[model samples]
Target chain A: MRGLLFSAAICLATSPALSDPLPSWGSTENKSTIISFVESVTDPTSPDYVTPADRIAVFDNDGTLWGEQPVYFQLIYALDRLKTKAEADPSILTSDILRAAAEGDLETVAAGGVEGLLEILAVSHSGMSVDAFQDDVRAWLDEARHPTTDMRYDAMIYQPMLELLSYLRDEGFQTWIVSGGGVHFIRAFAESAYNIPPEQVIGSAGPTEYVDGQVMKLPGIDFVDDKEGKPVGIDSRIGKRPIIAGGNSDGDFAMLEYTTAGDGPRLGILVHHTDAEREFAYDREGHIGVLNRGLDEGPDRGWVIVDMARDWEQVWPE
Target chain B: MRGLLFSAAICLATSPALSDPLPSWGSTENKSTIISFVESVTDPTSPDYVTPADRIAVFDNDGTLWGEQPVYFQLIYALDRLKTKAEADPSILTSDILRAAAEGDLETVAAGGVEGLLEILAVSHSGMSVDAFQDDVRAWLDEARHPTTDMRYDAMIYQPMLELLSYLRDEGFQTWIVSGGGVHFIRAFAESAYNIPPEQVIGSAGPTEYVDGQVMKLPGIDFVDDKEGKPVGIDSRIGKRPIIAGGNSDGDFAMLEYTTAGDGPRLGILVHHTDAEREFAYDREGHIGVLNRGLDEGPDRGWVIVDMARDWEQVWPE
Candidate 1:
């Protein structure tokens, strides 16, 4: 009986069907759809097959690949930095929004909206070399933990999305991160957390000064890669239309539209934050990553809306 | 006797020494220096060995990779485009510079300086979709010839540089074109001319608007990727410092400085055009690709100044 059990276990281990590429994803329609899309584009015999060089897959960083609850992780880092700066020299916190951010008043800071947040970010994140800023981000990521989950911020990356990224890469798609977050902030952790290189990560950036052989982060927004700017960023950076685009917000609507509108087989995926128990669930009314346009029009556009609760077998990686 | 001759020919064909990677380059110190630099960084046993992901090599487009004699090929294209536009509607040539440009008055247009050239570019280049702009560039490259060389502009690329690009790529380096030319213009032929993909080509760009799923190139320069801006462009686009940088002019001085200043094995190559008999040779006092700063300080900074006439066995590809 023991020999027969061993034989059965060996048979199961070698079975191709059991070797799922996306183990973190449940055997749901969303998972099947994603697999089908990848297979269709990768299979040489398929009519919709795309060349490997043209197979670009882009993902939004904040809400799409990771949790964006209790405000953005970047904002938290900025607030923390602001506090430290205020502790060292109180004169840095000139505005009320800056004061609120420095004081760790989430309510007041959140109420200040994007303009106020940009002001804080420009102040807290600039005046240092790019390398220094990146080092600071790396240090913060290493030390900082989620307020509620207590996990390292980098560890909060979705296991299912990681699996998807790996799967797509395995299928010859060059995975990229197109985010509304700061390029430096995303680049600092993107490689370690998501296995995406800094060159492949595109995001909002500030004007930088090349001084004394160092690129200093200047105190001004160069371009905000959100909403319509996402597509523009995609055009300027990639110089080619992405075959696959994944996001979780209205900010990604234009990107999805632009990607899908391209004359070929393209995939637009919207990660619907449906699992409140596993991750924070907010969309239309959410302060960050609002998805009103996507939610209302995604289905008609043939976009795959992955229900996080129903589709993901696991949220965080083990 | 016939068999002996055949055997000798076979031996010569199979000899590793005969398999020179840079066939277009002469047996010069520049070639050996370039090879040694590549070897040190690529050899795993070497102390200066770099990982494949970090093996980035940036190059300037206009004079470094190809001939930019008389004027930039892009300006020639813009002038040709201006003529066509003027023939259709003369009212479009409102400014003296535009009129001079349309009438092919090189002297008058040249006297107007960079400001005049920019005004002409902004007017002639905008109001078209990026795709359309690229298509126009492609069409121009297909038909346009250098007035002096009488060869197609794309065909005028340096054969030695082509070999160098391929050899570096073979050695696991990601070769990128960081040009002062328009991104759209460079992207059109970069992939075909140099085997460099569009995403790997960084350049100056105008603002773009996303309309009806098409990215429209709007008027006004967003950034000039020359001089100090080269390093800034490298930071924003590539997000990592290059290990190797190649250029022909002072515009590339900052880029070369930034690349070599990074803590690693680095190589800075300046292509000095000294082959007036074969290719136009104008530097230090040339209207385009001025090289006073690079000529003055490049040797002290350990930069390889490749005398084009001496180093290159051939100019244009066969």
Candidate 2:
């Protein structure tokens, strides 16, 4: 009995937790094609075998990894923060946007313009150490609710991509989020939400200052990683060209370009938000999550366009 | 005969250059110790077995991986560029530092202050795409010589570290350079000198701008990855905490701290410049490559302090 116990312990220590295959929850002909191609490349016996060194994969954060409906969850969190601060000190009420946010009128505040949104984001995100800001993000995420779904912001993350991350890890691929969002904001919840650690999350950042032995990372009005900056961020951060790139909009076009340029069996995937009934769907004309250029070039670039309406069996977790 | 011909074709198609363990041209003890540690971690049956995902290793650029004697090679390159620009414009001669740089008196230029160095770096580095900057760096490095060594800066690199990089790669460790120097400067020669590709080189950067249809990465007056910024850079870029971190100066303290704080078996090494005969040895008070606080706390922190005077046989490539 002791020998058997010892053997079980040895096995447990030696073997890593075997991750499940890429979520086929959104099973479709397109998804199957991608899975098969990836499997072939990873198989050592196959002619298209890729070594682990060449197995880098990158994912877009917003529409690709999680839902960005009604409003960006971070923006909502910022608005709430602004409201609370205003309640504490009525001086914030002097601003038109802050007054709108205080009244819980998100549409009016949002319609006030990018300047107004920047004002809210700057005030809420500035003047804190990265550690402190992360703690705040964690606290807010734990307590805050989505204005529409009422689900936790983290819960709104797509189930398919979460499965995809696990599947990729199992296949010896390192996955990273190359997003235009705040790096720390996503990094705080990435581990809990998707099993990705803080180091693996790359995003836009403001200038960080080391003051009095504390490192304070402030949200810069200047976006560090966005649009064309996406490719630059990936280049600066990952240093390796990703073999697989997935996204839903033009923000990811440069990333797709950079990834597909690698000399290997590369995959570029674009998630098309086509299911209006199950989830929000607005493409081409939509201000947010625009997918026009990517949609048009999908066929020419050999990018797999995942039709959410047809592909996903379920969108979010129960 | 047909079967033999088919076999030959298959071999030709599948042949990736067979990688061999290179001889680490160091004393028997250092070579043996390095080899044994690498072998143990690589062996699947060993207790220290590290999977490819966890096998990230980082190297310091200046003195640890390469020779930075007399002066940093990048600074030399910047000074040279400054001289060339001054020769063309003559108006650049208005500044005392520019005049000093034009005269090839680096000490005089450096004495002018950090602001002087910033002025030289800004004009020499700004107004180019990262690709263009990399190309310029490559062009300069291909011909630039170490004033003291009278050898190409590429040839001035430590051979043991080159061997270590190749050896780690063989053992499934992804090698990266976390330097306080310019990213483009290191990237220009990393691929050819250390066999590390451009993407794996992370270094100090300036603000970049994307305007109209062109992307321009300007060398910022403010350095992005330096001192405490080392860990921030590593966290921001590589997204993986290094399992092994090596450095020569106090600048790498934060990187060592971050690397050692990781949840697995980790190694932190400090290269002490004790060999004044082969290489300049002036730590604590040295202007370049100073190993002050690192030397003091290295023993307490359990960091392996490699005394160049006693530990290394060769300082530079033969």
Candidate 3:
């Protein structure tokens, strides 16, 4: 019994909770690597020790933090708006883009590529005050349930990722969302969902014009924050290069490259959706969050590829 | 004699050093109001108490924090670069705008208005990496002296304003520079001169595009941060409205209006240059830092107009 107590005490001291600060993450190499990297950089005596303001960690939103399976959440919002408007006034659907969007034909709508998507967004989102848009988004997020699991879109966010954000914030790091998503869309939920303040979130911005004592979002996207545009968005919004970057798609490849390329101990994490049972798992030819180039190049760049099935004990919050 | 000694001891107990925290500011109504507001907002027991994150204060850069005459310091940098570039390639001066800029024709540049000024900035600032442009601006600021005062341009920053920044920071306010000047240009000196970090400085941006392995400034003005643009820029960069705003020119009138209009006990200050003997003093028809609309509308808006000759104990630092 004495020996058993000693073993229990040793187990308690060496427990994963004591060894790993990231509770939701499993005892995989990816989780251990992340904890070790965070430990090294945060240590005062470590050569890689970075001050709080300089400890910037940028993360991609769509697939990195939440599920992007049934198309992006923003696209879902856009399509629903188009359907409502078309039903109210058929004239508004004179354009093929609106008709396609209203029909939920995403492939045709996406065939227009970035420019076509921006066109649809402009038609669906313009002519409203920022506050009004924010209110509308809030109302939608409140009621909109994911078709796959019947969970509120915000509730579908990764439990492990949320823990990671809290962990980083606890360590005095300023976390930011550098996503290929719309700035207005992400700003609406970033603070409540990720604990990252509005000023820290950087993404593609639509044109905004101030008129009649109100700022209105112009329907056109002035920039794209995907692929190479990721680094551009980071530089434009955040003047400094981030030390840590996390993403789950090829679109985030450039951001990870730009972040980890900087000298010293840097971390680039790619969250590979490998759990087909607990969550939707698709890659490369997948409709959204395609993990193609990142998978091939991650090894070359010393990036940690996180296998969701193996690395995360809890996929979604209970 | 005993009575006189007793009075002296009482006077020592109520010394101004212990009472008035802002020493550089004269014992004026403006200074008192500032202190009182800060005290009320910082005190937990006070009904008007504010959280630290919500205690944001935005200050106009030119004329408010530093001198913007004979022209904006950024314009001066642009013109100097235009001259240097034109000298290297005479053909570069073929453009009418470049010719006018190189000749120091302020009237023509001003007449061309926002578009013309943006055109000039694009010409002067494009085709360089952000780092290169930053280095160029840094080198110029280091060597450049004000023609009028023969003092280093950085040294021309307001002494009383410096004290105010420190005081506000000490009281947990995050002070930001909301300038009509170029962001890249202002970011170079904001940290070193005013202790405002690069991320906190919001200004007009020249066109920036991500290129091969580097982010380059495209030769065009994307957005202007003056007048209505100031409020728009604030909303774009910082989603939260600041409680306190300060400016010195008609250009800042809109920003002051927007900040003070928010729901709260707000403070708006207009720095009026009433000291011609110490510094340049011009109002409605001034070449730069024009102070017209603000002076006329300040009284009705309840904004405290700071008289440079009276409210400030000293203008430039010794």
Which residue pairs of candidate 1 clash? none
Clashing pairs in 2: A199-B239, A239-B199, B206-B220
Residue-level lDDT tens digits of model 2 in A1-318: 466557667776744344325554555678777777778888889988998866888998988898887767788778788878888998867677878877779788769887787767777887887678889999999998876778888998877777777778877988889887888789888988988876578888766664443456665554557687877777666656688999998888878877786676888999989888877787797557888899898879899888888887778866
By lDDT rank, best first, the candidates go 1, 3, 2
Tens digits of per-residue lDDT, candidate 1, A104-174, equal: 99899878887888789877889999999999999998899999999999999999999889888877889
Whole-model lDDT for model 2 versus the true structure? 0.77
Docking tier of model 3: it is: acceptable
Q: Which of the two, 1 or 3, has more lDDT?
A: 1
- Which of candidates 2 and 3 reaches a greater lDDT? 3
Q: Model 3: per-residue lDDT, tens digit, B207-261?
A: 6776654778898777788988888888778777788999999998888888888
DockQ of candidate 1 (2 decimals): 0.69
| Model 1 chain B: ten consecutive residues of lowest lDDT | B1-10
List each candidate's DockQ score: 0.69, 0.22, 0.37
| Ranking according to DockQ, highest score first | 1, 3, 2
lDDT of each: 0.90, 0.77, 0.85
